[model samples]
Target: MKKNVFFFLLLVSYMAVAQDTTVKKLQAESGRVIQKDPKDTLPKIWRIGGLYNLNLAQGSLRNWAAGGDEFSLTITSILSLFAFYQKDRHSWDNTLDFNFGFLRTTSLGSRKNDDRFDIVSKYGYAISSKWNLSGLFNFRTQFFKGYTYSTNVKTFASAFLSPANILISPGFDYRPNSDLSIFISPVTARWVIVKNDSISAKGFYGVDPGEHSKFELGAFLTANYLKDINKVLTYKGRLDIFSNYRHNPQNVDLFFSNIFSVKLSNVLSASWNLDFIYDDDTRLFGDNGTSPALQVKSLVGVGLLVKFGQGRER
Candidate 1:
């Protein structure tokens, strides 16, 4: 009986040791898995930034040989704001651009030379590595009254919101890199607004006579590109095309804009801007009366720029 009891006690001790060994093996495996697992990192969610430029020029001449104006002054300013967000395959970008200029000459007096206000917002959800489902909204208008100067008279041409354009589109976006994007929308809604009664009465900007606004359904395509040519020069451009299905579908509207900025110093820079537009419904008065034509504008200036905020460097 004593030998049997001793053997049973030995068997119980071995069973306890085996159970402890199994538990230690499971703990060691769990520790390895915990060390091998990747940490969950948070994404950078928001980026906000803006650029502002103010340009000034003045000239006073006493019997200039080149026959320029006796006294002239020009002031121009460009301001742009941007807000961008990215989180978990979703992105949103918003931008506001404004430009205004005034020129004073001894011969022509003080007049406004440039005016523009544009807003763009885009949101996207990634569908693939290079493609996204996107929605875009755009609004464009001018600041103040504009006039056409002639030898005899100065005719009122445009005013604030007189030729405002608004566009909303839901589409697919292709973005191969951070510098380029292309968007295509088969169905788009566009509005032309003429808030001024005088301008609306004349059927300006495709609005019917006595109507304040006009709406159209169309297809819209937009392409945007940004590049740093070198350390000192940067280029940004956008092209927009639209075709009105209810109207003359063959006559597509086009808007293209380009801006090149060269940094001369930390605060001083030179910039060149070019804008082109072609709208079939808009009329321009020429020697042969009224006709639709492509419009072009260009500006070049050296200015002081004040930049702020944190964003993707351009």
Candidate 2:
């Protein structure tokens, strides 16, 4: 895995050098020098934008005959940001996503509803109108400590970077359009990192007892898509599949996520996010917490919608 990562990085470096050489040769044919125009108002080649969502709800029961909570509150926030660049044959894109939710009531007071942090970066060189040579780097983790509640006890589950996932791959991407991309990789490297000692000892997310990290060499494929169903509705989704060549290759790992949005007005919108995952190495689900099972999560909110930027959404 280390050797493959090294070679992939080296190949990218060589490609950059070759591109630089071509640029120099092209400049040699021109003798006139152009000065930067102070009055030029052209847009930059790179486009940056982000969307922020904040949803809040509160309920109060006054003189309630039926049994009910006196006060209840729910708050959820999600932030997504992206920067994309396309110049000549080279393109680079980066994105960050964060989410957190809080819930409070008279019975279950102030429990965390959700938490996650994820980032992705990819670079591609166009090989054709519909194909590109690409490399991807992705990292996913959570922001806060997580807990599993029982009848009377709460068990510690995870913390920031306690069980983060990192993936690196060199692949070919087929772009049918600006809104969709499918990447295929025969070689992929993935790492599961457990930063907390206590968590590592417990071996929650595929790491062995007392081990800090686990490495895997595998094949990975990912697809990203975005579509506008209409003027007021939009959808985004991603799919990932991987198979470890060394251990249990027949049992593939999968991750799928979907996001849907409906615009009600300029400042108000409804959104829903659904995520599902299944890993051969993770056996933390089911009634015994020792058998592998599908994990699912979803969040629905109606809140403020704020978007900034010009070009595409990824």
Candidate 3:
């Protein structure tokens, strides 16, 4: 099934490229969508840009916080590159992105590592001024290493796992107004990994006979708004709701994240994120002496975004 889907995406991409080439050839000969103003007729492209952030925080009991953190830090890098061509009623878009990050926390004088890497691409098909659909594919990985408890033993199987990935996601966007937009994505992601029989008991990577990675569904809903704060600075807010459903354990997890951004200029920006998560099946099989439902939350994290390009305007 995954292989078939991949082939379909390849076919679509090729077809789109072929169509674009033909369109360009015809336009060059007849001067299609030519502008009266010479400045508007030149190819307009927005080059890619990226952002990197190093987050450091210290939480202590004296701070009156519900949770005590023994000094935690995270470093994240996000890069996005896209080129768009607009001619009259039609538009062509291409995007590529990569993100890699690591988080470290000290609990009870012991340090732990959490790392993640993601790569994604999107090709958009514009149907109208207010609507467009896109093809999305992404691959992600989280690694586990070095442990102090028996629980840590289970982590070994997750390490070095090839990766969990999304073959394709067909998504849509709707703009009700110039300043507001909404979007939704229905997607599936799958993975193959090994695990300690004693720990996964049911098998790892959901390969335990009755278990499978099928129907690993996910969805996202987002709201975006922007306000101008100055000639060069603008403020924006994004509210996002995300969820994941895996059939093996019959579980559903949901996340809510809100981000505030301040664009310093075309090439630099800063953001703060507040995220919360809820899990419907945090418990293991047969009560396992663990809670079956769970809720987790986090507050404001500072981050930064930067774009770099040669002879390119961000």
Candidate 4:
């Protein structure tokens, strides 16, 4: 698993570097001076530097096993990092995010684990300074390395699979300021045509219930906010909501997460994360429909957010 992750990261880094060189070459040779008059006062073309964060989650949010609450004494942890880069005035926004984690049950001295790799690309057309129309494309996979016992047999498989979690959504965004933004995607279509395994585990959020991999309809909404106080403190928050009704085992889920940061320098920061998850489908986890389940998790993390690229235009 570690080797694959290393190779994937190396490949992505190479691709990003190669693409930038191509873009530079094209701009240099194209006789079209894509710049405006010097006195007219339009900002120069420059690429936006990317932003990154590394997180360590603690408490109940750390458990990634099949059942919930039964592992309260468990100590689970998840590590997530993200980056984004785009050109000013460029109508498209691109993003790449990765999450990895494991779970350990202290009460029973048992351990279980899984991880996910997600890459999302979005294209947007600015409606104004505060609004935009966009489309999102996502590619996700579950990296599972553990034991599965069935049919009087036990086998261990270390592999990655993503059954029918692939879909495209057309959405809209509203950004009131640099600190807050909202996105809505309604009447979106989703289909999970095939998966490499029999029983489909949880969906992308790790909070959603299990369901059949087939055609599904849903809506998506996300809210994001960020604030900085002086050079020492900052806060960021995110909310994700998703629902699908047309597929087997109907479900609705809401997930809220926040991060508080203390800057030690221009390039280094310390962070703490809080996460909460709530869902309406108890049957998704094969429950008897007796009560609702909520998952809460927190973490303390420290990492570097490196911005590698030319600064953006004002």
Highest-scoring model, TM-score: 1
lDDT of each: 0.90, 0.89, 0.49, 0.58
Worst 10 residues of 3 by lDDT: 147-156
Over 4 Å off in model 2, which ranges? 1-43
Model 1 per-residue lDDT at 100: 95
lDDT of 4 by residue, 1-314 (tens): 99999999999999999999999998888966678677896554334444565443334535566654433332223333333433453455454445444554544344354344656566667778888887877665556654443345444422455432565889998878867878789866755532434334533223234554556578977787877766688777778777876543345666687778788777777777777867553222223323456756666666664445554111
Candidate 4 lands at a TM-score of: 0.57
Alpha carbon lDDT of residue 182, candidate 2? 96
What are the clash counts of all predictions, listed in order?
A: 0, 0, 2, 3
User: Tens-digit lDDT track for model 3 on 1-314?
Assistant: 99999999999999999999999998798976655875665664444444444344444354555766646566544454656445554545444544344555565343333344445444556677788775555554554443323333323333433224344566886766656656667664434333333334444334443433333556655555655556654444445444555553335454344445566555455655444544443332223433443333233344455545533211
In candidate 3, list every pair of residues with a backbone clash.
50-306, 51-306
> TM-score of predicted model 1?
0.84
Candidate 2, 160-227: lDDT as tens digits: 98879999999999999878999999999999999999888877777899999999999999999999
Better of 2 and 4 by lDDT: 2
Comparison by lDDT, 1 against 3, better one: 1
The TM-scores, one per candidate, come to 0.84, 0.84, 0.52, 0.57
